[model samples]
Target: MKTPVVYVALQQFCEADAAPRQRLLEAGFEVRQNTLGRRLRREEVPTFLAQADAVIAGVEPYDAEVLAALSKLRCISRCGVGTDSIDVDAAQRRGIAVYTTPDEVTEPVAQLTVAMILALARNFPQHLAASRAGRWEKRTGVLLSEWTVGLIGFGRIGRAVARDLSPFGPRLLVTDPALSSGEAPDGVQRVELAALLAQADVVSLHASRPPHAGALLGRHELASMKPGSYLVNTARGHLVDDAALVEALQSGHLAGAAIDVFATEPYTGALSQMPQVLCTPHVATLTRASRAAMERRAAAHVVEWWTQASCLTPTS
Candidate 1:
């Protein structure tokens, strides 16, 4: 009998923690990792996981075409929360179980979100740049306590951000159709998207990619935001239209933007060129503890699924 193969497609997995990989080895499964040192190209995914029974995935796309090509793949356990990269419906049709470590990612992402908000509010980046250039430049910055911070989504990460920001005494506004009135936390006002955009001094995106085709924040929505306000996005890249955001920043309509994700990664766009925009390489959930927890959970999901599938199989 051939041993089941589990492909670890996540670019960086269990580098510090060996428990997750050890668990798979102990489970009588042959575990293989992505050797390319980067996200596998779309064409490379099928070839790389050709014999995999399960995959511990990252932000790689697993569309219908790729799903159809993987004859033996039974599961795709995501090391992170978002499912935007995967064609979930297609995987379901092919009987591939998809899993994500939603709980594990909350703390790290929320922490980064708060950090970005504070940095933007106090003009930290500009100050740093000035000091490095051999010039003493001091600029007035706003206090978070005096600001109205709007959250675009009220899910786990959003709620966490609200909790962290509450102590700073900011008026919180959230817009999420999924949450009812009772679901809102104390002192957090649940408002419509338009109202949140207009009233917020700092608007942070925590929402998932909308089901429709267009960006959640287009030209009109960006225009509606309070002039000289800031934008912080630690969520999905496609949530904000890149060109529109660049234009807003260029026009001095928006004070600044701290972007952690982009429509296309390895992102070299207009946002990068602007001094007002602060960008990170989509690493909101990349802390040491966060990565370990997510990797362990993702690996556990694969082991659990494989064990269940093995027991259900009829033996000769």
Candidate 2:
């Protein structure tokens, strides 16, 4: 009998370092690697996954149409925490089990968020730029104690960021419709979105992408923020209106922003030219520890599904 095939659709990283793939192969499975070296389009994914027994997906879209096209697909193992890329309802309807590596990425992302917050507060980028040009100008920076940090969502990542930020002695405000006052973190007060927006000196986005089609932060929210406030987003790019953010930055409404994710990734756009904005190539969770943990768990999920004929779907 032919070995079952497992398809992997990772675009940015090398699968050669993927320990999970090695584990699967050792367990007597055949791995069909990426069909293309770059991110595959929606049309290309179905053709590749049609005969696959299992798939380890990255940020590629796995909607109802793509899910329906996969006749032999048994399970989808996500490399990271976010399920926004996959159609969960469709997967459930088709009886295809879905799993994610949430626990793997929590600490690394939390560390990155704190790093960006500090970098923004200290004007690190501006200082570096001036030093590179042979200037010795010392830039003034805001102390974390004097600032209020607002978290937009109170999930695992948000909670971890809150814990890390606690040591800095900054006041914490969290906004999540699902979280009641009783559920707020220790020393962190739960508040309405508008109140958080109005009071925060540094606003960090940790919310999941809602299925809606409009900007979560528009002109009004931006205007409501304190002048010279900073915005940091390690979450989904669509959560903020890029155009509105650019306008705020250009008009000096915001002090600066450190953004790790974008609406259109591998971003080549006007935002790249802005001096006040610090952009990372969506590598907040690219640490060796995080990568290894996520891959191992995702591989284990697939192995368990095959051996026990059951799913390991995480609730939350």
Candidate 3:
């Protein structure tokens, strides 16, 4: 019998810690890590896994073709929560088990969302740019406590954000079909998405991204928002219509927006040119502690699935 091959498709996996690689090697499995030095593109996926039995994937796309081509591919151990990148249904059709560590990803992402929320509230980035450039400008900024903060999704990260914001005493509103009355936090009222959009002074997106699910915040949604209100997205890029968001900002219908992910990556799009929006290169889970925990757990998922044909239970 041949030692099964495990491919590490995530380019940055094991960079902070090598325990994941060690576990695979110790299991009598041959491990191959991505050497691309960057994000693994969809076209490059198949060749990279020419003979893989399992893979620890990042946010790489695994469409029908990618899954059908991999005859030996048995499982996908996702390093993070979101499966929007992987064609999970297609993988399932091919008998590929897809696993994720949603529980391990909550806190880090929540922290970044809070940080961006505060930044938008203050307008300090805009002020700092001017002060450094030899001009001093003073503008009145709103307090978090005074605004109606609406969360678009009530999952792990959204729940965590609602809890973290409690200290600031903002009026919390949430909208998610899955939200339960038993699980609703103190002062957090669950409302419909349209209601959340209409009433919120600061709207934050925490929704899951299902592939082909059209933009949650498109032109009509943006138009529905209270003029001059802020938008923050730590969620998937495709959740917002890029052109519509830009139009909202330009027309002053929205005060500003902050995003952590983009529809098109290595984002050189118009959103970057806007001073009102703060963007991060999908670094929500890039913390050292988060990386270590996710990597260890992600590797464990692959190992367990390889031997027992099941991965760890997902939180969300």
Best prediction by TM-score = 1
Better of 1 and 2 by lDDT: 1
TM-score of each: 0.96, 0.92, 0.93
If both were scored by lDDT, which would come out higher, candidate 1 or candidate 3?
1
Could you give candidate 1's per-residue lDDT for residues 1-316 as a string of tens digits? 5799999998898887999999999998899999887788889999999999999999888888999999999999999988888888999999999999999999999999999999998898778778878889888998899899999999999999999999999999999999997888789999999999999999999988733456899899999999999999999888899999989998999999999988787798888867777899989999988999999999999999988998899777
The runs of at least 3 residues in candidate 3 whose Cα sits more than 4 Å from the true structure, single-residue gaps closed, are: 180-183, 309-316
Task: Give candidate 2 regions above 4 Å deviation.
Answer: 12-18, 35-37, 132-135, 211-213, 310-316
Error of 1 at 137 (Å): 1.6
TM-score of 1: 0.96
Alpha carbon deviation, residue 79, candidate 1 (Å): 0.5
lDDT of 1: 0.91
166 Cα displacement, candidate 3 (Å)? 0.8
Error of 2 at 27 (Å): 2.4
Instruction: Tell me the whole-model lDDT of each prediction, alpha carbons only.
Output: 0.91, 0.85, 0.87
By summed lDDT, which 10 consecutive residues of candidate 2 come out lowest?
Answer: 307-316
Error in Å for residue 200 of model 1: 0.4
Ranked candidates (TM-score, high to low): 1, 3, 2
Global CA lDDT of candidate 2, please? 0.85
Rate residue 103 of model 2 by lDDT: 86
